[model samples]
Target: MRGQRRVWVAAGVLGAAIVAAGLWGIGGRQDAPRAAAQPAGIPVTLARVAHEDLTQNIDGVGTVTSLHSVLVRPQVEGLLTALLVEEGQMVEKGQLLATIDDRAIAAALEQAEATRQSNQAQLRIVEQDLQRYRTLSQRGSISRQILEQTEAEAARLRGTLRGNQATIEAERVRLSYTRITSPVAGRVGIRNVDVGNLLRTNDSSGLFTVTQMSPISVVFALPQETLPRLQPLLGGAAPVVAHSRDGGELLGEGHLNSIDNQVASSTGTIRARAVFDNPDGKLWPGQFVTVDLRAGVLRNGLVLDSRAVRRGLDGAYVFRIEEGKAQKVPVRIVQEVEGRSLIEGLAAGDEVVLDGHSRLTPGARVEIQGDAQALARRSQP
Candidate 1:
């Protein structure tokens, strides 16, 4: 009986040990899955934040325009006898551009002058006769009524002389109008009328178009938000530059000429104009261009790569690495310049995570792969 009891106890002990081993194995399998689910460390790319001058600028599209443009037209109606200026030729102000057939106008002027000279001679003779009549009446050699008649005749002759003189002056003015001259100093465009073409005073189409190309105007629009900052700088005499469509080449440099008084309600923008010396004729009227309004230098500002900035539920923030862990720092962006951001709430030297920000959380560990020198080189100056 004693041997059987000992056998049963031994069997019980072995069965208990087997059950415990199976439970341990099950727990180990569950824990293995959990361990695999958790990440070992957060993988991220980092960039060092440094200070640099951040230029706050606004960009917009604009068109080149001539400072002055005019359509050349004849002031009088006549046959076009001569065209002195060629198409696309430069002309000065008051330079004779064309001449109309002035033979009829000249003949009228000559006839008027001859009549005026005859009137002047008759007026002289009448004046002398009136003086002699007055003296004869005062000496009682002639009747008072006869002297009065002579005086009235003299006055009529004087009036006729004045009328003839006015006619002559009018004819002279009409003759001078036959010669067409440039109203301004500019380059002439294609001519619409050729020699022997009959031009009329009532015609609306001009003979040619002239434009001042040396000093050109550029008109551009700016967003309402950017206008306040730019308004103060515009008062200063500073140079602005325009770039090509690709932004690789500089089209020209100019100064802000004027700003519109009212903002555009529909677009929430303001129009501004600038003047450029286009001696090379690089800018032409109605040609679209890119405008850059350069605000003055910014001293001691913190700049970061534009990619480093991220939008969160709260606001704009950046991933700053502190003690090998990323901390989301809220920042206020002042401006964006050349693919970089000018921000507040950041110091001179801070390590910011530029890439892999989506996977990173506050207090998450980070691994910086490259040196600061490489990042510095990559940053825009």
Candidate 2:
């Protein structure tokens, strides 16, 4: 009985020793990898939080629109005689664009002039006869009926002369319409009618379009809630900036020209326009762009590089460095533009991580990037 009990005790002791060794081995392996995984703290750059005035940039998508766009059409029906202007030609106000066949109008004007001359001659003859008849009637050499007939003839000839004169004026006005001129100063678009094509006033397709390019305007919409803020700055005082659709290039700069009187019921927004003196012709008609309207300034606020602001589950937060450790601080972003942001939670003089956030967590030890760089340079020599 004593030998069996001894054997059972020996087996139990060996089993306990094996279990202890296995646990120590597993724990040792874990500690080795843990120390190797993070031999040094995460290296990250830092940026200081500062307080300054930030300009509030209200961004929106807009389209470049011309203030004046006119579709050139013939005012009268006639065969297109000549195309004086070509497609894409820049023209001035009253500049000749095309001409209709004026030969018919010219012939009609000549005929009217001839009739006017004939009427004038007949009127002269009738007046002279009336004058002679009047003298004879006064001398009692003719009847009163004869004097009345002479006066009546003179009045009839005067009416004919007046009618002829009016016809001449009408013909002259029609003749002027034969020459088509641009009503506004602008660049002409595609030509719809070539020379020798008969054009009519009722033609559905117009001759072309004259679109003013310079002093151009961009039309955009803003939320209806912005009406009060936009109303007071509609006097061309608020500066407007335009960027390319990709926002890589600055298209032009201008000022707010006007705002819609009423908000659109369907869009819940109000329309506004900004005018630019597009001297370089960078702004083209019907081009889409991103607009930044300078509404106002945001007074004093905390400013930080936008890169430092990181989105977290709790909203926006920044990895602030304190005692060489990262502290995730929740922040409220007030305004963000370009590469800077105005935050509400953090105070001035707080250092936040600018980059190297791939392995960062709350309370993670961090090494200052500047200090690490200096140490590396010193060690190299």
Candidate 3:
């Protein structure tokens, strides 16, 4: 019975080994075909070369400034009686902004005027006497000495009248200073001196600041390297746009006005000013902003998406797609602005790869990803 059982076990082991070997051979055959198959083309996005006028803009940070900024300070010493305009009020040139105590100046003016009237009446009486004395001397009724003394009296009175007239004028000018007016057409700043406070001509703090807003100015700085390009745009109608510091919100539009005479040696930058007609009053002084100044335009430029231009060991180049294959083309970058690059060495309507450039090489096959909207914005001006 033991011999029969041992023979049966050996037969079962041999059958199991044969079935396992057959399964292993089938798995090897399936893997062999997959390893031999060629790789698929690299996925990429493409844009056609565009022939259009490409505008080049240089971007920099700037500050909103006022064209005319003046301190509204008192010209004479007096007690502040009233403030006609409130803080942050918009005022015109010569508009009354505040009033100082004018009683002292008015009293002095009245006193001078009264003295002038008295002197004038006395001078008239003396002149009549002098004229009669001259006529009497001619008729031999008055002595020559009397006529000369009368002439001297008339001259003295005339001098006193002239002095009085000058005092009255000086008093009038001092009285005018009591009424403070806006020196410029602009918005007022915070009041430094309150009503009923004493105001002095030499006060360190002024009453307020009046800054012109309608025609405001923006002062910005550009890199020294851009000086050559910036010189030609000065005094021209170079459009300047003021945007929020994040470069998203449109604040206002202006033009290049002036450039600083010398570049800042410490910062290697040049300061420039732009004038904007701020009709909407959106711009405020001391506000930081992003400025876009027109540098120049490329005529009939070979416009390519900025992403398509890649920097390699041999300088800038682009991978152009020709007949579904990436052909490496050397290019020169003229200008780049707003994600569009003005490039050379590519013809209009030629397609270039804008994305998935990592897997690209000369003559490598590519698979294009389609997007009408992206393609339109990428290439077309």
- The alpha-carbon root-mean-square deviation between model 1 and the true structure, to one decimal in Å, is 4.3
Clashes per model (N, Cα, C within 3 A): 0, 0, 0
What lDDT tens digits, residue by residue, belong to model 2 across residues 12-127? Answer: 99999999999999999989998987768898988888777889888888999998999988888899989898888889999998889888889999999999898889889888
TM-score of 3: 0.77
Candidate 3 displacement at residue 289 in angstroms: 1.0
lDDT of 3 by residue, 193-300 (tens): 788898988997899999999899899999999999899987787999999999999999999999999999999999999999999998999999999998777677
RMSD of each: 4.3, 7.4, 7.1
Alpha-carbon error at 176 in model 3, in Å? 1.3
Question: Model 2: C-alpha RMSD to truth?
Answer: 7.4
Cα lDDT for residue 81, candidate 1:
94
- C-alpha-based local distance difference test score of model 3: 0.89
Give the higher-lDDT candidate: 2 or 3.
3
10 residues in a row with least lDDT, candidate 3 = 372-381
Which runs of model 2 end up more than 4 angstroms from their true locations?
1-48, 122-163, 310-332, 349-381
